[model samples]
Target: MAVIYLVPPVSYTCPNNTTCCDDPTFDTSVFKRTIATEFHLICDKSWLQSFFQTLFQSGVMAGSLMFGIASDRYGRRPAVIVAVMLELCTGIIAAFMTGYWSFTFVRMITGAATGGIMVVTFVLLMEFIGTDKRSMFSAIFHVPFAMGHMSLPLFAYFYRDYVQFQFAISVANVIVLIYICLLPESPRWLLAMNKVNEVVTILTKVAIINKMPTDTIRQAVEQYHINYHVSSIPKGSVADLFRTSNLRRNIVVMSFTWFACSFSFFGMAQYVSYLTGDIFLNVFASGAVCFCACLVAIPMLTFMKRKKAVAICNATCGVCLLIIAFIPDGILGMVFACLGMLLNFLVFIIIYLYCTEMFPTVVRNAALGFSSMMARVGSMIAPFVVALKPHGQWCAPVLFGVLPLISAVLCLMLPETKDIRLMTTLEEGEAIGQSSRKIGTK
Candidate 1:
């Protein structure tokens, strides 16, 4: 999250600042050259900034899909350890690289590592905790990410004169490596891999810490031994994601959600300067407010069902973005921006949780990786739309509104997973997701 908040500004600031500021003498071509060299590290002619972002993010997403397969095949703990180490090394190398190409390649590798880390960490934490408490814990995990997001702009404001922000981000990630080393492996993963001895040992430790009966824990584990054997390998191609079968609907709905939500989210974020009367102060204030709103989402997740909660948030976000589109450049603009920030905070909560819930264990992380790739496609292209010549003050917000509106409609087609158990196979997910809607149980 820290890197997510930092990297965009660092890469695009040269361009964003120049575009917005009414400096007639400033060369737009210089903005393109500086941003491309720094962001892509590709000094090659014909490289566009958006194209580089797409290529970089697609590689990261593919790497994430592979990591998910590795984790599911091997174990979550090993996968996370390897990913974090890679991230730390790549980030440090990125900080010290001499030329644009070297740094860009290093950052691409770093993105890949970070993608794996994100998926494994989330899956591990959810599997480590009990079902009743999973949503609560998952929501808690997002708070630190929100804090990191809010802290990034301040870092950027202070670090503008130096290019050492990359080094600082790398140092912070190294600290993450320390934390990862100390954390325990997921007991669920141990059980799934048929490592009963390890699972028993971990459960015993957990029972002792919680002051629970070891016999009771063992009994629970014994009752859970129904081996509904499914295919270990993912059958078919990436095109299977779009077939008229179970995987297709999930893919289509998820793809739409990913594209729409991301477009709106980044669209609003990119125009933070224009949304409010005083760009600097408003950006700071809105960031803090959004952070608080993220905290509110935790409790909401606990009390409310996931489907209805996400629907409400999406509807609210769409409305807010629409409102922002119409407001003039004054106090009304600030009001609309604040409303949009609140909605964005809520929409983000849904995105994080819903993306994870929408697939089975076999392809769960892979599904997220694919959806995230699509989202990055939206993110890469969204800025350019607002930057297009015909677009003016209202263009960003209008596009933002349009995107979420589509998301709201597509979301209605998805089945709720609030009460459904985490599925372990495609067949199970397809049956449950389809039947859950028919049975009218969210």
Candidate 2:
């Protein structure tokens, strides 16, 4: 099955002055089934392959906004359950799709659901944990994703059939949906919603499970309720992100950083086949590098200021990618390319934690969703940019390198969030940024 997708179809010459041209046919003797061969997505229809990829990202962009709003209006648990179910159904249907158009449409739906799940899950995790432990939890969060990445090739290797591979991957969502059913709703969300009893009930259970006093949990909830009323923080909308000057600046800069990160990360992943002949090895190597970086990120987040660490990692990633553009194809080139990807992975982890920390609780999901939507834009365009490699090999790498380097510089413009408490209102968020800027100027 791997051989079918990797091998190029045989070419034939047309007779001179012939009215008809030779249509290229794949050698299907070794493996008879694949999405490419099944739909004739080779040769003249090759552009459609790239278009199919873009549709998924477009759906993700749209879904991020929709689910983000839904999460804010409803609750995290409900939004997540709906997103997972959508993904599960669409993914299963996609495996059975016979037509290219139908398959593409299903993929888009899956991508949208996936986008919603990703943002909501991250926010839920952050909201559940203590601020002191968020850095550690954020670092640990990537482990499952890295494991999934590492597991994909193994699944693909064993399944051999595209439909089987799709089904295998989609079935995992069923397990997630079941697990989600048992989890508690976010207590912070309950507090924000003024459901003091629910917050106390959940916190009491948590304390009892941890062998702590339930009275302490109840008192904390009581204190939180009092503070919530005193603060009088209004519910925020998506438009709140751009309603003020400081917020608008933060959004613009952060959005670009998200774009840069996604552009470089996905660009490298997508072009691995072109970068090296050993596609399987490259994929495994990249995933391994990312896994190790996740380990490294735990300590980095624990000790370093978020802004400085992100800036340094982004700069290092850019330089390494730039070096890869000049290195000749060999073992050394592979090493440098892997190093660049590793640094980018580190930057990715830190930026996610940093962004989550920076935004006020009222608009955190909205801000994350909007940033991720910008990232989807970068991801959508990455393949097209990589496609320019046929025109000039350096074009793609140069673009990848430049984007991150620019983002690294932009990192300095944002505030440092180390040791800072999460903001509960837009005014508080703005004041924090302003104070940080004033201190930096001094």
Candidate 3:
């Protein structure tokens, strides 16, 4: 949501054919500065706008790291409440803020909350379900994000008024706040926190909901002695990520993948809105194509081998970007744009699944959270990068095209893990990598 707000505003080109007061406005810039400077609401200073926009990503990265630590130490529910409250407060202020700097500050704060929510949400949802169901749920998670991404342009188009859009975003958060209140605490979090009693209670409720026998769950918990203190579950500092050779490898791969994925995803998402003709039609078409590509990837991965699926997705994305880089701005360019847009969706699902499988339970969320932060870093730079390219120039496409090729090379370094248990421990992941099996042989 924060990305949805910040990027487009910074990219806003003033309407009166004038350059931004703070920076040069490229010919292809979408948001007109005349409207921003004239209206004095949505934007004020160009550099400030860009600064606030990029700050959201940096803040989210820092905030999510803190949230991950807090969730591990305290519990998922409490950390989530902190995030929620922050959301409600910052969101309201952003909606009603009259000054540019004031609202931008609120955006940064709200971005932090958004990041925390994302890290916690994915971890909690996976914990709530059985292991076998995790992949399915993880894939399903992207649908809402895809919907939200698509919805942004639609709302921005219809509202045409900045304050109105902010109000709508705030109203949506109110719904989320109420929704979160009704959800129960994650039992896995309870177990990790050593609150055996609470874990049992939550597990029992979950068993009842699923119409499963609670006795089996209770027996398993007792057998595992979940209440056993794990003093080694130390402060999951980011540095802990490099303690082992295998973990260090996982971190490097995921970090690179995350950055590449974000660059491709947002670079195209925001750029599509700036396409030369029919802004609404172009944005809608691009978003819809990407969403469809995501849907197609789910089944392909389910039936195809994991390594093949990912490798193919990367190759497809690279090829599409390359095509887009060279295509002239006309009918053929439109076709390549649509294809490149779909590849964003494809890359998203592949990277998302791959990242989740790379780490063990001990640091799964932390690794994923940190990787997500890096991805946002890519998103932060995307708007500025696009701003540098001349209108009708293919420079941005060439650059976007190159990142995926590099990502494809990195993808080659990861071991395939299809038809295998999800890695939750450092030792377990390393063993799989060393296993005597075909890389994609199941």
Best by TM-score: 2
Model 2, residue 433: C-alpha shift (Å): 1.2
Residues 17-120 of candidate 2 have per-residue lDDT tens digits of 23224354555543345666567665467667567668888888888878977887788889999999999999999889878888889989999998899888
Sort by TM-score, top down from the best: 2, 3, 1
Q: How far off is residue 13 in model 2, in Å?
A: 9.7
RMSD of every candidate to native, in Å, equals 5.4, 3.7, 4.4
Query: What does candidate 3 score on TM?
Result: 0.85
Report the Cα lDDT for residue 382, model 1.
66
What are the models' TM-scores?
0.81, 0.92, 0.85
lDDT of 1 by residue, 1-442 (tens): 2332333332223343544322223232212223333444222332354444444555566567767667776778888899999988988787677665665677778878877887788888866766577677777776766666666666655554224666676777778888898777777666555556677788899889989889776666655534544324243234445554666787777777777776666556656644434434556666776777767877787788766776777777778767766766677766676676677667666666776666666666666667766776776676565454135766777777777766777777777766455665566656755565532222
List candidate 1 segments past 4 Å from native. 1-56, 227-244, 273-283, 437-442
What C-alpha lDDT do the candidate models reach, one value each? Answer: 0.64, 0.78, 0.67
Clashes of 3: 11
TM-score of the candidate numbered 1? 0.81
| Model 2 spans > 4 angstroms off | 1-22, 27-32, 228-231, 437-442
Structure candidate 1, residue pairs in collision:
41-100
